[model samples]
Target: MELINQTRASLIDYVCAQIATFFPDGADTKAAITRNFAEAMGRVEKCFGAIRPWPAGKFNYLQSAQYCLFLYYLANTIWRNDDDSGTATRLFLLNKTLNGIDLFYEIQMPDIFVLGHSSGIVLAKATYGNYLVLHQHCTVGRNYEVAPVLGEGVVMYPGSSVIGRCRVGDHSVISIGTQVVNRDTPGNCTIYQGDGGELAVRPAGRNLIEEIFRV
Candidate 1:
């Protein structure tokens, strides 16, 4: 993949600088970053290449959404491969500080996903699937320690939420501003808040995931 305005060494330095600036604790990040940087970028490439909105095989560090995903992959790579919790924590904090997104590094995200806007988005530790797309002010969180399980090709629009023991089926579209709490949806459905604030479901009519991803 083409890394716009970043070579491997430059990107590593950039991340280390961000961590140091945000944390200012004098912790060593170079070793952990060096150990896991390539794997992390590989994951980023795979994800970015799959998304249709993003130009395939190219990564732009100036883009907030792409940078957010990069930070997540970097943190996750270090955590999983090097068992470097301190560095991983710093990366997570840096991402939150810069992007206003609360995506913990430990959360097991799928290999291919898209974030329309990272601001005001919170993704909890839950079962996720490939080709998931999340927009601004969207949330997939837990209720009383119970999180929602999302299937393949799920799309959560802006201001939409799926909280607490919800089973969102494959190709399901959670409409804008809809709140799905403690409910289940069938595959290929669109979830919305009906009249009187009740949950409603209807066929999505089109495959949004197919359009967004190179599936």
Candidate 2:
């Protein structure tokens, strides 16, 4: 499913990714994280779109054809990382085309993403829905503790880890430098690590107006 304010989210996500690359604790710099993500993603999309092979101004961003082209670009990154076969690659496109994305652990797939300098990587019985993002050195493995079911638009930050059987809801943002194990999280919530493997959730309907950083 497409996220609410997907463009904004995508943009912010990209920026956050960049900062994370440079700074281990970038997410703590909330304002920089927010600003960079939006700008970087927007530029990549715009620049890439301009360079794509379009005939005589026929490339309309709203059109299905154009959208697929962009998705293909993004999907290619994952494909290359997993060393996926052509057939597997096509299947990914098909899934992305039909369902936006469905990289669940149980789903038939060959190419899984692994970022560089990212080790200790693992995932089992996890359903990685579409637009899934992973930064360097994150892990998704199961413990006798919990198995994870990742929803669409799920992101894992560097040094952040998850293990056990739990569900991470759609459009959920996993905070950088956070580690989660056997935690059930709500949709569209910003995730943070607290003491004892617990998470701090900022739910949508909940007010952030007071800067009520719950401990």
Candidate 3:
């Protein structure tokens, strides 16, 4: 994998600089960044490599979506393995400020996932599966202290939401602007709103997950 416009050392500096802009105590996180950056980047490489055609084997700092995932990996890695809550918090805040996304470090996102347009996306600490695709303004939130469990190859389109104790099966597509609130959908289907504004499911005509990822 190639890191564009940023060498490993430069990327570390860039992240530290970005954190400093929002948090004056950024200097304390340099060690954690140096310690966890390589592992986090390896995760990024694996994710990017799984994507089709574009954004594969390349980590471009200028690309907001790629950078957003990178920050998430870094923050999550630090939080999971190190005793540096402050560092992880700074990274999470920096990512939110830069990407307009609210993915907390504690959220256990899948390893093979992609983000489209990234902004205004809020993911709660839910059960996510591999090859997950999330578009802008898409949300996976909790309702009444219960979150949804999404299976493999689930795609949440722009403005779509899944809240509460829902089981979104494998290869299911949550259609744009559709909200699945405390509902369930079987695998290999598309969940859309019917003419009467009710949730409807139908067999998916195509494998959208395959189109986006090299499954």
Candidate 4:
């Protein structure tokens, strides 16, 4: 999706302000922090182009919260180096308390992914695809040492999980309340819990990311 350029600078400045809050006494760190913030904002702008106005307007409260949470994590994980552990921890805890986004547990962001909501979501250090949308109450975790590998354009609806060493194909949707463990899902399909709690798959209705955002 093409981003609206008018709000980009404001958004970057806001993110830099947030990073500054964690290092009030570190004037020496300002230059490095600002540089990292710029890099993080680039990734955030690419991933969350759908949410306008940076923190978003009043009517888009959920989107605003989600964007903030994403920024917090991205700033620490994707941009800042390991030398900034103290500041990164502070930002991580703040995000967890404010947005209930538990990304501290080995979660890493994809180059471009969207969060539908910021509550009850758990992500591990798995291979996430671009244009992924994660709704509320979703989990993408590992089983022992094995992690799930998701293809591009995947969507996980509320209460859905893709666990273990499963491979989910591109354009696949994990329907609400579905749990996929140690299985492989094909591309352009939807998976749901069927009778007796069995996981089922069918052709996906449409390309949501393409249809909605034309990304």
Backbone clash tally (model 1): 0
Candidates, ranked, lDDT: 1, 3, 4, 2
lDDT of 2 by residue, 10-129 (tens): 634543454355445423433433433333334335433333233322324344333433333333443344444432344343434443433331332112221222233344555566
lDDT of 4 by residue, 65-129 (tens): 54555556454653345456554555566566566666762356666666677688878888988
How many clashing pairs per prediction, in order? 0, 14, 0, 0
True-structure lDDT of candidate 2: 0.49
Cα miss at 140, model 1 (Å)? Answer: 1.0
TM-score per prediction, in order, is: 0.97, 0.42, 0.96, 0.76
Q: What is the lDDT of residue 119 in candidate 1?
A: 93
Best by lDDT, which number? 1
Stretches of candidate 4 above 4 Å error? 1-32, 50-66, 77-82
Model 2 TM:
0.42
Off-target runs (Cα >4 Å) in candidate 2 are 1-120, 203-215
User: What residue runs in model 1 are displaced by over 4 Å at the alpha carbon?
Assistant: none
RMSD (Cα, Å) for all candidates, in order, is 0.9, 16.0, 1.3, 4.8
Winner of 2 and 4 under TM-score:
4
Clashing pairs in 3: none
